[model samples]
Target: MRAAVLTGFGAPLSVRSVPEPRADGGEVVVEVLATCVLPYTGEVFGGRRDYPLEPPVVPGPGGVGRVVRVGPDATRLRVGDLVWCDPTVRSRDDALTPDIMLQGLSSRGEGGARLARHLPDGAFAEFMRVPTENVHPLPPEALDDPARWSCLVVYAIPYGGLLAAGLEAGETVLVSGSTGNLGSAAVAMALAMGAGRVIAPGRDRAALDLLADRFGRRVRPVELTGDEETDRDAMSAAARGPIDVVIDLLPPAAPSSVTRTAAMTVREFGRVVLMGGVGMLGGADLALPYPWLMRNSVTVRGRWSCPRTANVGLIRLIASGTLDLSPDRIRTFPLDAVNDAIAYAAAHGGPFDRTVLTPRAG
Candidate 1:
């Protein structure tokens, strides 16, 4: 099996022939069909974000594949099962404070624990050994394009946050940075979850227009010109009323000023959920004017990825064709071209327009 191997921290990932993984107790060996390169993958490669994986390990978070073998005691799943593994695996030391796992960022054990009992390298290789716990059986509808499931984490992030915020059917929602993968998923998932309306506020008019074209009038596009007051007013105008909930998807890699503009778009007593990697890449702290927050009675909360139940719901919805993920154009690459895939995903593709790596291609 060949894999995109992490040579060292901040070093380029090298493609190398590695031994194929085998199923151990409570584990499953999956032949990787498709995987994705997200912005976080780039951040981790650049050493900007922290995860449990270290050098000499595979660097993928999720993938689509068929189980070739199942270990003893792993009765929950079976051989030949088509599955999509969750990005997060249970830590070897779950007894440790969960924060040490960086809120599910650490899938493998610390430092050089690759393809061992305690850890499973990510799905960047031809085959991956995964704990059955992290694996979810896929419906036939998703098997043809398991790559779509790789983007589930992005969709689940905002979905989890919205669920936490008690998003209602008739409430207006504002999705900041709506052109990016997480933001794009936020728009679609919000609508699928029954938001009364969704306002996409971003600096990219073309992307916003494309988003609106996909979802129709229910999605309103708001163009941001880097002017605080102007953008805030534009958000309000786009929504046609108070923004009941704001899902801030602007990463810390984006301009810090954009955060303030998003927070301001919410109406009095509205909820603001921050789910993206807001400060992971080093940026200005999110500025919250306490006086205004108190006066408006705005509530702010933080979130990481979504949990199991939400992902199950999302997968079932996708299976039902209720969400119609087929409309999105997914870009793909061979396993050896992982670097190029990462670059493209980081610079251009969003969840609606994503990039995937086909491990079997090479």
Candidate 2:
């Protein structure tokens, strides 16, 4: 087997041949078909807080793949099945409850039984052995180009957040960072879930135009100028109508002005869902309107990962073709270029697109 192995913090991943894995009892070996290029891969490279990570490991949250080998004890899935192989799973036990077992991110777990991120080896390889229960069969439409559909999980990030915030049909939504991978996913799901209109704000104008072109008029674009008042006014005008929900997908380190702009765009008593990694924000304080929130009864919430129920519901919606997510752009890479793929995702700023690595030998 070949994988992109990270040797240490801030080191580039090296492509090297390693031992191919066999499906142990209760596990299944997937011939990697496609995996999303997550920006968080860079965080793993730099060693995020309390992660206790080291080199010589494969890092991936998992993606769509076909079952190549099934362990003797595995019952639900069979070889040749196309499935979503995100290693993370929700756990009720206290030991793993903080975040659904931190699945697909943690590097330690005993193969098929307990939830763990695949240590020493990850989905950025030709083959990966995953827990049988973690695999969910996907529809044939998704399988035709698994890389594109593999992004269904990203959209689920916003879907779950919206529903949890008590989203109502025909409500309007304002999504910050609307041109990034997660932001773009949020826009798609907001419309599919029945948001009457969506306002997408970002720094790039071309990307905004592109999204507006794909999603049609229902999606309005907001270009943020560095000038605070200018950006705020633009956002407010785009969202002239009351915004039912505000989805904050900005990087944790983003300027407080971004949140303030988003806050100003929301309608009174509207909800705000702040989500995603802390990398971009980095402890920045939000310039929230305390008086407004108190007077209008606004509720603010934070979320980590998509809960199991939300993940299941979104998958059903996509499988039923109710979500119509085929407009997403997917960039392809070979197994040998996993590092480049991750870097590309980390550097991309123009438009939202999914970077996918294909490990199958052609």
Candidate 3:
């Protein structure tokens, strides 16, 4: 099997032959079809992102694949089944508080690091082994265009945040940092899930305009002015009414003030879900006014990755035509061109531009 192996941090990936994976009692082997190349691939590869990924391993989080071998414990899954292999692997030993690791990418704490030791490889290769629970069946139609379905990998993160915020139909939602890839997807997902309006706030005027153009009246783009109070006011006004929910997806480079500004716009009793990297890179902690939160009866919570069930929810949205997956958004590359694909992804890191690697030769 051929895989692009990351020998070490700051080292170039070596694409060469590696031992083929086999399924065990509780795992399944998938023939990698299409996997997304994240925009931050170069950052992770160059040791800039500081992802706790010990190298000499294949480095792709997850992808769309076909089942080639199923373990004995599996009942429903069979060979040749189209599936989306989720990289968010949770330790089965503990259900309530499981140690999680994004296979072939990074881990959380020591517990997650330990989990990674057992499942070190990811979907960057011709064939990869994954836990049975992490493999979800996709519609048969997905076989026709696996790269289209692979877009689900990008959209699912925002779906989880929206779910955590308890977003409801007809409610006005504000997406902080809505110009970026994941944040832009949140805008689309909110619309798909029946949000009456989505307030997209960002400093990128062109990206904001693109969002408005794509979604029309349902989307209100607020070009941020970097002034915390002004940005917050603009986001609130763009909602046309009270902001029912606020989902913060700001990246690490964004200041805590930005998140604070977006979150404060939520209406009384509204929810705020933090699913970004704002504070992860070491900075001032997000300081919200205690009096405002208490008086407004605001509900604030932080969420990591999406719940396991989110994969199914995303599939349903895409299948129902509520969420579009136009082929124009995708650019495919062969497995051998993994490095080039990474560069292309970083350069094309826009709202819906997708860079996919097809490991299997047609």
For lDDT, the strongest prediction is 3
Candidate 3 clash pair list: none
Candidate 2 lDDT, 1-362, residue by residue in tens: 78777787777888888899888876788888887776666766766533444456776667788899998887778788988875555443455543344333553234322434333356888888776777788877776777877676577678878887787888989988788778887888888888888999888778798889988989989887777678767876886678889888876557767776776667778898888544442565675767878988888898765666676778888877778767666788888887788777777634456777887735
lDDT of 2: 0.74
TM-score of 3: 0.98
Write out the backbone clash pairs for model 1: 181-351
Kindly list the per-residue Cα lDDT of model 3 for residues 1-362, writing each as its tens digit: 99999999888788999999999999999999999988888889898889999878898989999899999999999999999998899988898999999998889899999989899999889999999998999988888899878778788888999999888999999999899988998999999999999999888888898899889999999988889888887888888899999999888888999999999999999999999889778899999999999999999998887999999888998988888877238899998889899999989987888899999947
Q: Model-by-model lDDT, in order?
A: 0.77, 0.74, 0.90
Candidates ranked by TM-score: 3, 1, 2
TM-score of each: 0.88, 0.85, 0.98
Please estimate how well model 3 matches the true structure, expressed as its whole-model Cα lDDT.
0.90
Instruction: List runs of model 2 lying over 4 Å from the truth.
Output: 22-26, 43-52, 69-74, 95-120, 226-233, 278-283, 287-289, 347-349
lDDT of 1 by residue, 1-362 (tens): 79888887788889999888788887788888888777667877777766555567777877788889998878678788888877654444444533212211254344223333245377788888877777888887666677776666566678888887789988999988788878998899889888989999877778888888999989998888889898888888888888899988887678667887888889899999988767766778888899989999999987666655676787786788766677777889898799999888887665487788889742
Clashes of each: 1, 9, 0
